[model samples]
Target chain A: MSDSTLTVERVSLRIGTFALQDISFSLAPGQVYGILGPSGAGKSVLLETIAGFYWPDHGRILIEGRDVTRAAPEARRVGFMFQDYALFPHLTVAQNVKFGLQFRRSRPRPTEHSQVQDLLARLGLEQIAERHPSNLSGGEKQRVALARALAMEPAFFLFDEPLSALDARTRDSLREELRTLLRELGVPAIYVTHDQTEALVLADRLAVIRDGVLLQEGTPSEVFGAPVDEFVARFVGVETIIAGRVLCTHDGVATVQVTPERRIEAVDHGAVRSPSVLVCIRPEDVALNRPPAKDSAGANQFPGRVVGGEPLGPMLKVKLDCGFPLTAFVTKRTYLDLKLAPGAEVVAHIEAAAVHLIGQP
Target chain B: MRTQTLGQSRGLVFVFSVVGGLLLAFILVPLLRMYATQTPATLMQIAAIEDVQSAIWLSLEAAFLTALLAGALGVPLAYLLARTTFPGKGVVEAVVDLPLAIPHTVVGIALLFVFGRTGIIGGPVNAVTGFQFWGTWGGIVIAMLFVSVTYTVNAARVGFESVDARLERVARTLGAGPWSVFGRVTLPLAWRGIVTGLMLTYARSISEFGAVIILTYYPMTAPVKIYDLFLQSGLDESSAMAVLFLTASLAVFIILRHLSYGRVTPGGRRM
Candidate 1:
């Protein structure tokens, strides 16, 4: 790792009934390591522990190759943006941005005042520099918080559900804005959130945590496309996960029997050592077609009836009973053109490459 | 059903207004009647008296000192109570509030046991410094503080509780030490509650009679002096002094409240 990299080495901490067990991850400069977890899954606790708010029981936190495990938060040079944006209600926007500048032990930079003004102006907050937090909108508070944290010129940043409190419309726009800002700043960051889309968009590297345990860590697509377990499959938006037994393997592809009469073809990747397995399929990967009259089923094709579906924006989330329940995402136009509705017979086609198989534990 | 519920609420409001208005009148009528009995000339005469002036000054000074001391000693305890959980915290909170539950005279006697000339703390300090709490300004301040410190501690605790702990954590992340965070973030955010508490402590201390008379009857506070005049002369003479003291207290209280309120609502926005 480079000198600017942050490494959490085998960190384990227990707060109340929740504990993070031997969790470890590292982030290089310009990397956004997103920790994705459900509520009460100890994501916030892990972030706080890294920020020096809580000490780990058995681990070392190294920032810039220096152990900061026992350091006070002020000595750690880590910027933390809270879920609620935690803007000081008593201070104006300009003053809030200027707050950390006075505490710097280094000689004051000549352009410090202009630097703060530039930050606020860049975030489009210069007009309301004199307004208190209560007078600003949710998006405005978020920008001010970002400016304040960035003003400190921290080595790393930790954001806990930074956009969770905003309305959906604001959250969507700010999510893109935040991604651009993080990329431009080139500071390593740990963004913790339960929102899958946010993690997918913002994370250069992603880790899924559950019940205080780190389940999986990889690139966003690697973790989303090839989940290690059934929980991860469901969490990363894989709508269909069903138990299956491998019947045969050939050319790195295995035919798994989901039911007595139904089977699936999945690329084994040589990880499946057991006969029992889970067939994980993303909804978008399943293609729907008209059922054939003859019972000439393709390798990974199954005839089924549409049980129900609902329109999700421009796409439709379709539930089909292809011997076993399977979910498919089809465009609204496809649904209309196919005259697909409840009780309509259709064929679901899943390619071997699209099917992810995890050995059943 | 909604109309019936609205009508019932209206009836409840009517009943509340009647009872509340009667209580307000009950409190205001006595003070108004006392004030009506005193003319401007008589009140001016009582205010001009050197003894009355000195006694009122003593009350203000003692109460101000009590408030300052309570703030310095009680704010940390308040912050701990607001932020941390510990064993026997309930006991500590109850002890802080014990004076409010006890009679003022009992508080006076309880304080006298610890602060008298021959008392545990008072004896050693008097032996070393040749200063005593008996009939001294220290006794007056101790008496007032004993009965009034609860307001400062409780109010400051509530104030500290109102501030979000995350703000302090963020301040630390921005390179502020513990004391800097407290001074820059927590103190500013919690000041309103602390100030309100101090104001209540000052008002309560100034009105303290039972405790003050027992501890130091010679260097008389306004309340004790008014009691002395009522007993020594008659209602007419004492009422003039009462009117003067009441006016002074009301003026100071109103001015303090106005100043705080004005600062709080700079843009005419209700926080």
Candidate 2:
């Protein structure tokens, strides 16, 4: 019987200097839950404690209601894939995949052959099955590690930064592949990573951990689109969350007045029409135009002067003081065409659909 | 590949060869004298002595057993020293390798004092056990263990340290318990280096003279037998025993070293 639910309840473990304080979260079966945090955020420690490595200083871990806090890692029946993929160097891909299954004290031994073949094919490692880890590429090693973990038919999957060690290109592709693989197999998994983009793309729900404390956990939209606090809000993105009042509503869309006397409209939530409401928006949602000809149609416009602008890769993130100083994202090409400089008068036009009214105030 | 640098390289090579040749001369000349008196028939005849044969076998057994003890005790200590960081880690590490610098005779005397009848820890231990370690196979084992502990401890420590801790963490998350992870991932990877260390320790123990001489001069090992034969019989008998012991110990050492480095086929053929 496969357990689809992994519950970590108040698991507090202090490893060295980092202390995980009463961390708790539950993941539904077949969903990839990512533990996301900055470096030294106790993210890896949390994953390890749940996997039964570091004995929790307090609390219990329940896999579908059974307390496994004191259980051995192998006895816990969880599969852990590491950032380096940690393929056994001496073993071929086939042998590596068969490692966990071979240890089962069962009636019939799981043959090294078929289990290897099935998982290798599943992970597209069939052709490379006979090769050692040192011979495989990064993506290939990642797959081999995944294959090895999955071959055991584990109760839950634990991914400790599976894509963190890969080159950028491989990480991008493998993230999608890993998410798809977990989904297709319907294996409940807990993934830990510092890479926010990977968490955003791969996790069904994101648990934001910082300094060993779980700051928040929700669906990607819930965690990212509707973060809980100031740090989470900034970590999700460097944009601002504004508390404002719904000045008016037309055809179910309400305009909220923001700080620095700017009005923004979002697909209205009934609660948002109250005296105060909070709207979450990313810098990418705002576009800068030269004073949008006094009044723009089908757009929420606010006049602001560019205070700062920086080009980072394909996008230009500009700081604007449209009332409240805020950042707006545009293409580098767009920045150049608009000649967006500091103190430049620009109209910040926001798409109504992009203004995310997160939660009740 | 410039002419000036090539000339410098050649000059350096000449100097290195000269120094190496002198050192080889210093080592090989004395060894050649030890074997120079032997003829084939005399070698065969003297080597056929049963007492000398038994002593050599005893020495080999003692060395092998001692190496096994070192491997069992030293690997875990090495692992702890390598993977963990705690207060006085450096002090602990230095203490583990301290035997290497200490004279083996001092070790034998220390073992004797500790395990000797009226000695500090030895008195209680001997009284409790009623079994003697003095002049016994047990004493030989203790002597060899003391002398060779650094071999297994240092090499296996480096081996364990070479492994990424992240891998163990991964194994843990993979549902492998601490013990299983150690047995599966940690032990297997470090086995090669540990085997090499064990073989080297065995070689050193087998060839040891000073410690064995100090502790148990009886139930004579080959080195002891050779020394006794030199005093009692003469050079011919002593040289024969020496050659025999040397050949056997060297052969086993080479075989162990080869086994450590080379792959063995399932059918027992070393590749």
Candidate 3:
């Protein structure tokens, strides 16, 4: 259990036109790594390959440093929770949890009852333990499936869009619960999902996959802030990428100056080497000021004119016609207070920490 | 346009009624003949006979055995064919279903060749087990199994196919092996279909006359006994046997329908 580290080394599987080509990732013990991609992105295929459902056409999958590329799903001891929560229609909740226990019947363990109860209780599924999956809601069914998978106490876990079937509210809550469970279990979990928010919320590290290839893998903050490519940058919901250059470096921070006027600041360590660098920032993080505030808390102000403001419920998303045309989100009250309108002069004050220093694109 | 549509609808109803009534009569006539009798007590008296009793018992035994045989063998093959990618799957399916297209007499002849006293494996098999198949109950069972079990096998195959293979695979990853997963997940989901198949197999075997007569005429099952009564006794005796069999068959049909359609499964019921 301690040495369970699942690694997929350049595994390539071809199924007709769809394929996972040169896909590689390693799940360290207790870390939840999300494989995020669009539909038809081979995310599910990669998960299935790891679960030993699909034998990859090339490369190998090593579970605990043991090559299990050809092993049967049961032999691999890799628990796969399907998107549909494929709970047994016949077995009661208790029986479903006990199903895997029966497989290891030859050498019966004493911890079966307590472990099963503990898991059911942990999932808040104790009352439903005697009930069947058909009786449960989508979220309940998912928890039962999770409990069932965890009951076996497999080497690692594979979740194929566990939250995709749930409602938005249920998804958010379940994500937190799943995160807690995975941490408690201390087994690496590979979560496959197409939902960007689900990946961001669930995974300690998110890997963006598209058409079977691993585009990028890093912590949520790292991947979201400094995406390696434009495709990944948009995937992480960072729409605005301004081409800026390192003007100067003071106190381990690079002063990146973009456009004719706006000066953006970002942390500059070893990689902020050249004058030419791309400054990345999220639209929501950008601030639109009424009059140019020269000095603000960690905020570098820029001169710009309001091109348009789109009222989205309580918030107003104003588009600034700066050099890069920044989008800033502000409250409707603030928008009204400032009397912001199209062709009006505004200040774009971006926090130094908010400005991301990405690789030159 | 509305009045014309209504007029066309009325005409459609008239045409549909004429066709539907004819179709209903086509199915209902034979059923009416089987149940309609000179008197209610007559069928009861006919069924009271020792030979009639034996024929009914034999029919039950043979059909039950055939169903059991089909279930035991059909499930594994169904799962294998449903879950795996293998060479010659269509060929295997065709071969399994060959009995449905083949004449029952041919099936009898085939069984005779395989299980007869002077047959290929039959001679050695008879020497070892001291069992005779040409006229014994075993021959009846084999012949019944041959035709009856195919319906069960194919239907069960369809049932097994209806279950998503991913469910079983997920169960396997949940620590269920091939056997446990099939038992816990696949079997329950597919049970209703398999049960329907088993019922069909039972009904078919019990009613099967051609193969049973050709294979084992001595141990006359219900259908065979009915045929014999028609030949030896008269139309009256045959009618009585028919009435009795109709009752038994109807009861079985009702039981099967009840078992299959009575309620949602416990899992579904909870929802």
Candidate 4:
């Protein structure tokens, strides 16, 4: 790893009944490593352990090639943005931002004031500098928290659901703002959240955790597009998963018989070394077309009927019975263009590469 | 519908006012009657008495001293009780509240066993430095503190508890050491509770008569002196002193309450 990289090597921690088992990842500088998990999955615990709030039972956390497993949080030089923002309710915005400057012994006195001013200005918090936390709105508090943490000039940043407390509109805007801010600061950050959209948006690399185990880690697209297991597929919003028997393989494609009457072709990717497999397909990748379209010879296309659908914001989630149950997400414009409704005849078209196959024993 | 609700609420308010008014009159009637008994001239005469002045001074000094000392001693225990969970925490909390459960005389007697001139801590201390808690200002302070320290500890604990632990954790992450976090974030956030606790401690200490008389009668606090006058002279003579002391205590109490709940900005700075 580079000198600016943070590495957690086989770190294992057990708090009460929850155990983070042999979790390991490395984050390069200026990259945001997002940890995605459901509640009680030890995502926050892992972040806290990296921040030196908890010591791992085994393994080590190293920041910039220095072992910080046993260092105090202050000595670790890591800035943490808590889930609730955790602004000092008793301090104004400027005071809260300046709180850490007093403890920075290495920095000379002259630049600290201007540095705080610069951070406040950068976060657009100068106008609210005199306001107490209680008087500010949720988005204002979040920006102040970001400015405060950035003011510390930390070596690394740890954010625990920093936007979770805000309303949906605020959270969406702040997530983009946080991503831009993290990039500008050039600090490696571990953003932990259970929200998949947040992980997809903010994470340069993502890790999915469940029951304290690091299930998978990769680029957001890589993890979401091709999950390695059934749990991961489901967690990443792969709506169609079916047990299949691989009857044959050719040209990196496997013809898997999902049911006796239904056969599908999916990219093998050399992952289908076993006869038994699970066919995973993302809902968004499945396209619905009106019947009587030209079906390319031997292409993965099946005639189906729309069983039901519900409007999901601008997209419609259509349940299809294509000899087997499948789900497809289409835009409202397409739904209107096709005049899709319950019992509407449709053709489900899926690409070979979109069909991710996970090997089963 | 709004008229019906308003009518029902008016009837409820009438019932509440009747019971609350009776309770308020029960407390105020005797104090008002006593004030009416003494003219301004007679009350000034009693306040001019040197003995009464010294005794009132002593009471204020001892109570203020007790509050400061208890704050120094009790705040850390309060923080610990609020933040940590140890094996015997329940027992420790109960012990902190033991004085409040017991009578003041019992507290005085219990303190005497530890701080009396010939007692455990007092025996060695008296021999070493010729300092004695018995029949001294120290005796009065210890007696008052024993009975009133609970208020300080409990109030500060509630204050510390109201502060989010995450704030302290974030402070630590922001380059603050543990002590710096406590001073900057925890203490300031918990200040209102601590001040209120100290106010209550001071008020309770000033009114501590049972423990003070049992420990030391020579350095008479206002309450003990008033009792002494009531026993030696009669109702008329002591009542004047009582009214004077009552007025002084009320004035101080009201001022302290205002100071404790003063106009503090949301940032916790006093405005």
Candidate 5:
């Protein structure tokens, strides 16, 4: 009953032994909800179900407040872009775009002809409109698919790994254009991808799905900043997860004891019912240096030796065994300034907010 | 191992060439000799004869109709076999290829039992419509279709299989119905293979002798007529008929192959 553009309520489906259990989410107008997961995680299957390709075994699907769970794909008024861009191989580029336009049930707009032409021109496909899909490059095929979907003027768009088939160079260049285009359309979209970077770049809100289960859903920063479980923490690039026991909670902060003499302060996520919890920290959030000034107070600092350093482009991943293992990504300049080879002593500084608490171990 | 010089094996080459040459000549010599037996003037004269002209005309018409019928009935079945998994799919496929496995003469006799007058379905059909299949053009078409329909079905199946299923699903999301998706996406992409099937069906139908002779002999097809003439008149008359039929079949085959690649039209935009 919410006023979201699309709502999937308590959907469950079983295909053989694999089952998608109790998936529920809603999308507001003009919002892009990126479903990020690895391959075979039912990301594409969920998209297809929302588009009305398959009826869920349980639950309701609504588009713009109308229930369409049992409706056919064409009747659902949902535009879908497939992973491979699925442009009709026999049709010319113009014909492919015009295909959806021909099926519009409403009155013809005064500028119908100009609308298709404008889309082709907007996608930089005016010159290739006469050519068949077999003659198109990967990026061109993707644009053609987008144009075809847009021509339908559906209630919302569902994209399934739209850029996964493109080469790395084409994907990088097309990502920005696609982002701008989706924003300009001002319609709700659900973009599905297995690549975390793609999801982070394109999603307003994100959901990390795993093995047909909805693991986590929130804004990109919320999910990336504070993952709810170890699977998610690792999936989102949080390399350092320390097992700890919650010693106490005061105000909104909780002290989790990592070792016999060491303790770290983290924002107390209300779901921490158990005495034992996992302290999650991202490598990029930790700062590595010799030591802080005496005036700098209330900084979580630890002295450790650099066990290994691997250069990752402009940064270095420094592995340290400080009583327990910890990893930090330092800038190349920091790595060079420290001259810190193996067994070199260095201090790692972490702010109170940088340490995130996961309620479930 | 040492490499042998090209000129060092001239004697061995001569022996090999002589054997290969004889096999090639074995096929070409008979056909060439048949063609050379008729002067251009005699070929023209023989083509104008009433019996010869009618028999050739019947053969072409029946084959063309058979191809059209096969395409209409077989393409959908081919698509089904290509896309879906049914319980008896293997059995269905094996039956489609059964024509190729069995002898052509046995196929003729098999058709007789099913489509003959007083046969199972044929008896009821004749009783209701009063149109007999035996010794009629209907019989000839059925006979030709039984043996040649597989070529069309298998070709169309290959064509439909090559089309990615994602294309159809994408079309559906674009507001196209199932029929629209097939016509706009599946059929056109698979056109070349379907055309090849049609060509094979037509050629097989026209050249069918045993089946047509058994099912319908009154409205004589070209092959049956040529055989009859060979028995009554001589080799001269039959060879002249063979040359004429071969030339016509070749012309049609070449035209089909040429048109297959250039079927691009403004409407379909086929590649």
Candidate 6:
């Protein structure tokens, strides 16, 4: 895209036993691309590569259509915010924000002071400007770090687990504020985190990585609704992942036999001919009812015993065993009205469109 | 149970007091006795003496020079040691600490072997400079540095290690070159540890006697002067010199310690 602010082209890096193999992504202006993965997924390494801390072994990085793969981080015009905030413990909040400005090649504009002041005020960090980083709360430290990074007014931003170091409550609140901040800045940003919800909420697009390889990349809804593989499906909150045999493909729909008596019909997305495949169903997509009427017979409906039910805030997550286990989350009010319990019999309905088949790796 | 813990703690306190107290007294007694032996009148008289004053001045100058040199050479080495993993890193670390483990006298002898006249680089160095490390202020500084630079290196290593590398990366991305990152972010953050290291180096360098004596006794440091005075004229005169030197060094050291470690103002700008 002409408006792409950052493009990482086939970037690969080898560090000891681990390697990031051919990671390629592009982010347009006003886009937040979240890299979601487990801890050792090389997410931070990719972010650092973009930030010019680590040079990739075999790839190019272009910022605003200019090749800067070999450029120094300072010359690349990138801003990075670390997980720990890295607020320069020796500097006050105001001074930390001013640190980058002093090193910038451009002469100070008349609005420099007020620009910094405006950032601090916008982040609600004005009161703590004179205080050192050690004195600020986790949320405050995050805001100050954001303000500092923004003072540089770089081409793009890279964040490494930005909200992970905060407590859950603080993370929840800061997540929204950060999303808003990123939106308001309207700059392409790469947000790296292991949390799916964080990625889903903050990123305009999501990349799922595992073991240093880019597994899948798509919009939040696309990745969550239909992950490309089992790893991605499980990582993106699809609670039920079933290894099944492709019994047959009929009229562009594949019948995946999860068990002898349990078969699922799914529209084949071109890999159904594989001997083995994984049928992934999101818990939110599975509809559960106390019982099905006689006229409600469907090829994808099955009788199941409720093996477990747990309340998750306003949702009740129910586990079912219909030859194979399936999980479904129902509204708490509906769950309560249904009188669902561990030993109760229920009908599980799965629309063929909602059943995604990924070739077993 | 409460009484048992209290009694046990009391017994531990007694034991600790006895052992710690003996060691404390052992250190404090000689210095206190040296100070007590000199009246403010005798101290003033000693201070007024040209040799004593010169020796004191030389010691301070040599120590300051030693610290500055050590910091310049050792800080980069410390940063390298702290950050990078090389083949012989452990050995390098151990070698840096070799001075601390070896006897001060042996350190002097080792310095003599390498930097002394008629020795390895010493002969060539002597010919080139028309002077030898022996009987020179350079020798005194080298001697002091040989024994004390480790403290600076180690302290600076710890300081550099404590400064998170992530911050450096962030600085780089924020448009700071490597040198700028080091100067603005790494150095400022690690300043306290480096300052402490320099202070230790200064204190160690100023007090060094054996090495300085072995290497260059002519331009006497305070300790060497005190030793020479003790040999030529017994206790009273030497004690007066010791008292004067101790008070002056201690006062200066205390003031420096206070300035460095004491109330570091906000933003730590003073540090």
lDDT by residue (A1-361, candidate 2, tens digit) is 3354888878888777879999888888778888888888988778778777778999988887788899877777778777777777767778788877766666266465776788889889889877777777777887788788887777778888877777888878887777777778888888888887888888888899899989998898878866766678778884867777777789978878776456888876454435567677789878778875456655577778989988866788899887876788888778888889998889887778777664444
Tell me each candidate's TM-score. Answer: 0.96, 0.81, 0.84, 0.96, 0.91, 0.91
Model 2: which residue pairs collide?
A: A4-A29, A73-B175, A74-B175, A80-B174, A260-A323, B114-B122
How do all the candidates rank in terms of DockQ, highest first? 4, 1, 6, 3, 5, 2
- Please give, for residues A1-361, the per-residue lDDT of candidate 3 as tens digits: 3254888889999999988889877888878888888888998888888887889999988999888889988888777888768887777888777667656755457777887888889888988888877778876887788788777778888888877877778878878877877787687888988887778877888899998889998898888877877788878877577788787888877887786676777876556656777777787787776775656444467777888888765678888877667888888877887778898887787767777776663
Task: Quickly count the clashes in candidate 1.
Answer: 0
Can you tell me which runs of candidate 3 are displaced by over 4 Å? A1-4, A55-71, A75-77, A105-111, A183-188, A242-279, A291-320, A323-325, A335-347, A351-361, B1-22, B109-130, B256-271
Compared with the true structure, what per-residue lDDT tens digits does model 5 show for residues B92-209? 9999998888787887788888888867867888999998888888999999999999999999999889888888898898898999888988998788778889989999999999
Interface RMSD of each: 2.8, 5.4, 2.1, 1.8, 3.5, 2.5
The sequence of per-residue lDDT tens digits that candidate 1 reaches over residues A103-192 is 886846776889889999888998999898888887788789888988888888899998897888889988988888888778789999
Question: For model 4, what fraction of the real interface contacts is kept?
Answer: 0.84
Ranked by DockQ, the better of candidates 4 and 6 is 4
Of the two candidates 3 and 5, the one with more favorable DockQ, higher being better, is 3
Tens-place lDDT per residue, model 2, B117-193, is: 66676577678887667768877877888888889898898888777777776666555667888998888777766
Q: What is the lDDT of residue A97 in candidate 1?
A: 97
Identify the candidate with maximal lDDT. Answer: 1
DockQ of 5: 0.47
lDDT of 4 by residue, A169-275 (tens): 98888787778877877888889999999999999999999998999999999999989899888988999999999999989888999989889999877866899
> By DockQ thresholds, what CAPRI class is model 3?
medium
Order the candidate numbers by lDDT, best to worst: 1, 4, 5, 6, 3, 2
| Cα lDDT computed for each candidate against the true fold | 0.89, 0.79, 0.80, 0.88, 0.86, 0.86
The local distance difference test score of model 3 is: 0.80
* DockQ value of candidate 6: 0.58
Q: Candidate 1: where is the Cα deviation over 4 Å? A: A1-4, A109-111, A293-297, B1-8, B264-271
User: Candidate 5 — which pairs collide?
Assistant: none
